[model samples]
Target: MSDFFEALPGAVGSPPQHYGNPLGEQKILVDGSAVVDLGHRGIVTVSGSDRLTWLDSLTSQSIAGLQPGDSGETLQLDINGRLEYAIRVVDDGDTAWLLVDADEAAGLLAWLSKMRFMLRVELADRSADFATIGSLGTPAIEAAAPNGVPLVWHDPWSSVVRGGHQYAQVAEHPGAEWSYSETLVAPSALAAASALPVAGTLALDALRIAAWRPRLATEADEKTIPHELDWLRSAVHLTKGCYRGQETVAKVHNLGHPPRRLVMLHIDGSDGVLPAPGDPVAVHDASDIADAAIGTVTSSALHYELGPIALAVIKRGTEHDAELAILSDGIRIAAAQEVIVPRDAGAEANVPRLPRLGAVRR
Candidate 1:
């Protein structure tokens, strides 16, 4: 058993407890005056005469409205409106920096480059040159941004700001009332901040699951659309002009309902284990497991405060209080549904419906 799992009380399973680095309690990182290292987050630069217009036409958010020093989250969709990538777009007057998942940076750059036939847009990966760090809670926020610079404090997600000439500070998984900032500092400064515990990718994943925030590739699937994940208000811009797959976004949102939907899962902590991403989540009361398969687990974690929690994508009408299960090699892990977004939000009401999935009509 790895030191990480050896320190824990649960039994270590097939996938070794440490696939990468064993991030200890140091995973959370905060300790009065400590600095921590944020795992793989990369930056993509988009520059050209038609940068704004080109990006505006491709992403789900309204990039045309972005002003200098402003940043927002946007989704890059495939031809069918399926999410290819979720990125934080930051405009710094001269260049537009896209902060994307490290794993997707190369693919995103290649895809965007191929599509730039005549458009004056250049896309390049800037991951090696930047470091992303998370600064959370009241103290971290104050320390990161001492002077209120007319910044927007949107909660339950990360936000960013360029530091010096080569660094940017971004927020990561801002949960409920808690706040965090992802600092993109220079590599030289990292050693100075080494005293701060380095946070592992697992900790960030757990934080995201606990907060019920959907992640790319995990919570989001090719068959899945943003609206079903309740990303309309955050990642999609209903008022924005046309983009690839805008038709599907408009059609489903205005005339049809998404086949599946995202929801929160609160696991029975007594079970002593949490389900991994891609695990099947079943409705326990059903006689046939296949028939009751409502969704797949996207992200999950054992929170210090919330115990085992997860974000899942289930059929729209699945009973909220229905008993849930995570099946792995004949082992049935118990779970329960916990609705994060209310069914009757005004924004969801405006969604157009067609071939509805018994989606609630407000």
Candidate 2:
């Protein structure tokens, strides 16, 4: 927790988790009546004529043509297409502000510095100059326009953008109503915000989980790819020109399937214990194995409307209707699966497989 977070009244935990009313906070937050102190978030600024094009040459989003006040989410993937950084970016004409979890800020800055060989871009960690505040509407954030442009970054997760894909097979995605945004404010503005009803990260995360939002900080592992979490819906642009990890992304979405897929688990809360992240999710009915684990829970929360729910990543072959169990602290809890990324998600081009040279044509 930063000094800013510690100073908030009624705050709890090392990095305050809540003001002792997370559930209640969620209720009010949805209606834009409350604000969440996101002081733990980090901000980095990039300024230069080459900033936009340079960023376009990197990351997974198509932002080279981004105009001032345009907000988007982009993923920084490793050479092999594994996620490294999930960046929320907003440009204010003079600079591009990159927002991320605090732990990722330093590394993201370092990586950008290393890549700015001949570019005119300059980078800085502006976390000390600003704090982050989250809200569902612009009323709380619209006044923080330092450069005559509000720094609030409206999330693009509500719908699929051009060149993006949706893997979740549902009549309506829970994220359609997720109108979340993070705004950067000065220290004075942050202090003045104490007058508003305050929520904590716990409340924010609960709403996020119910919305089926994939957070890179919690959901990603070394082997995880965008396709597995349906990240392409917001972060990756399929028709964009070449960038890091673009080949692997194209290959997976066109010719192959992601090894794993994300799912939402509606947990049975009779035990009164919610499963934690990294808990093993297994098939409830086993054949030969004693306890066969299928996937691992990535995040869990007691949702205001959904009771207890979690997001887990399971094998692509796991049956969509499989009865699932989560092993948390030696307690086996039954869970019902909600398909996120379907089993047949990839191979979008649907090219036919060719017969082997040694085999006769059928």
Candidate 3:
């Protein structure tokens, strides 16, 4: 977005892709002392004494208890609870700040304004007023967040949060130590990042996917629900008061199966090529033409440590040990499924048997 950024030394790439040395830069960026200009991200601010309650009533998180300097995430769904947008949020007493996709900023702002009604809330799309900077391991926004409140939304994906559930049966999440932060900065603050080793969306994405992070850019679909991407880890609070899509969420989580489930694919790197998003994912069969695609690749990246890896949403009925193949740019690449969301995702079948009568643990 800034020609100035392109001209910086080692800043040698375009937006929405890799910049600088990806792996080398990643080490620096994650150290918490460096910054990554999330220019592709947008910012919105909701200010007023009523901001917390108003937002809590509209989204899928329990945010009325959010205090100044507190941070979290929320989802905006349609009346039927289909996702419309995802937001990273923080409140600094005077303002409730939102970090969202830049492309959706205008629409989200307009929607929020129309919903104000008689509420004492003030809303503004502040993308023009501020830029976003991200860091992990330490606080890089101290120089920018004047209040020293951080205004940083710490990522809570690593642990099972209150009112949330985990679908990944792994004892420890690969991203368990993924302590990251994103904060608002003025254009002037971008100067701070220019001097540090730089990493871009591409680097961030590779690490994110490897950690099994469900990002809106890749994981969400038209009919996508929280259960599919295991997003309930942080974004949805089950015990929270009703919000749009809450009924659908509850119905599916408690009684129904998410038609599809997310998985990680360890793509064969023999060709040294990667599949693009939406590439057809078919059942792997060397003996015949691959059966009709059972799923599609949602995101793919060549991680420095894991090599070619991807995330896909396949039918929940797909065998957990199914061999998969991805058709990419005309070449068929082999893929092995690493279960992220179990096949029986929506059903919790571990109900223990009763001792004397048909009783169960509360």
Candidate 4:
């Protein structure tokens, strides 16, 4: 931990959620003049000649072809195709750096270690060796190069990569304007980096939600599939050969729709309180006797540009034009849904459907 960050005014918690002014910090951060302390994140390193191929065989993205300084994101799914892990990957030829949520590092490392039976790959949890700092522009800190490899992971959410698919049909995606990256630097360098303009996770998250970026820590539940978040836009390689859960991925994209879809909520801030994750997202019946549970708020933030916005995952059958409401702490906050993944998304192969077994031909 950086003594400078710990001693900063209004600093609190292990990661310093904010330094006095979160919204102000967000404003500067969006202007590309501030860095956010992300020391709470976790880092893992994979090395060995087979590192790339080994990862390729286990993840949703095509990793075998990544070269030095190449960046990508990948997902680890359960056999049923529910998301288990989401990883930010950057390769430096000799080693691959994996940046993940702090809570996920240990479990991910254990899972990977169990899978490395005969592969000549080595894995290490490097969170203690380096701290993560994020910026909207190029990283403000000089990245560490302990092994002659600069460790910085440029975010790929700005655009879809090859073999990746986008489910959103908007004329323009908000993520196009997002320029985010995370840099790993020595703990000793944090104090020096903190000398520059600084933001906090709250600011970073507000920007992230505005960008329509799906973060694993919040966006995913045990039942989440990549398609629901449109994660294939930058994370999954649809054409990539077999990997864990690939079967379900291909099947869903080719012939089925995800049971749920992601949406951005323009929350009514009249209550002067932001809705937290897991809040019920619903719609009132015409009689007003009941409220239909459509989804749950997954992430929420007060963005500098957009106030009190949130992301939710709702039932695929939820009417797109329906008026939505968020129930938080016994207060009902009206919300307007901005579609992230359209209800009609998927079945990209356009396979012709067959008539029902008992249907009579007209």
Error of 2 at 78 (Å): 0.9
Steric clashes per prediction: 16, 0, 1, 0
TM-scores vs. true structure, each candidate: 0.75, 0.96, 0.91, 0.96
Model 3, stretches more than 4 Å misplaced? 139-143, 146-148, 286-291, 349-362
Q: Pick by lDDT: which candidate is best?
A: 4
Which residue window of length 10 is worst by lDDT in model 4? 284-293
Tens digit of per-residue lDDT, candidate 4, span 1-362: 55567678888755777898999999898788888888678988899999999999999999899989888899999999999999999899899999998889999999999999988899999988888889998745788887677888889999998899999889999999899999898877887888888888888899899899999899999899999999999999998889989999999999999999999999899989799999888874422212567789999999887899999999998888988888888777889999999999899899998999999999
Give the alpha carbon lDDT tens digit for every residue of 331-358 in model 1.
6777877764333222333645476786
Model 1 TM-score is: 0.75
CA lDDT scores, all candidates in order: 0.61, 0.87, 0.80, 0.89
Q: List the residue pairs that clash in candidate 2.
A: none
RMSD of 4: 1.6
Put down candidate 2 lDDT per residue, 54-77, tens digits, no spaces: 998999999988888999999999
lDDT-better candidate, 1 vs 2: 2
Clashing pairs in 3: 81-245
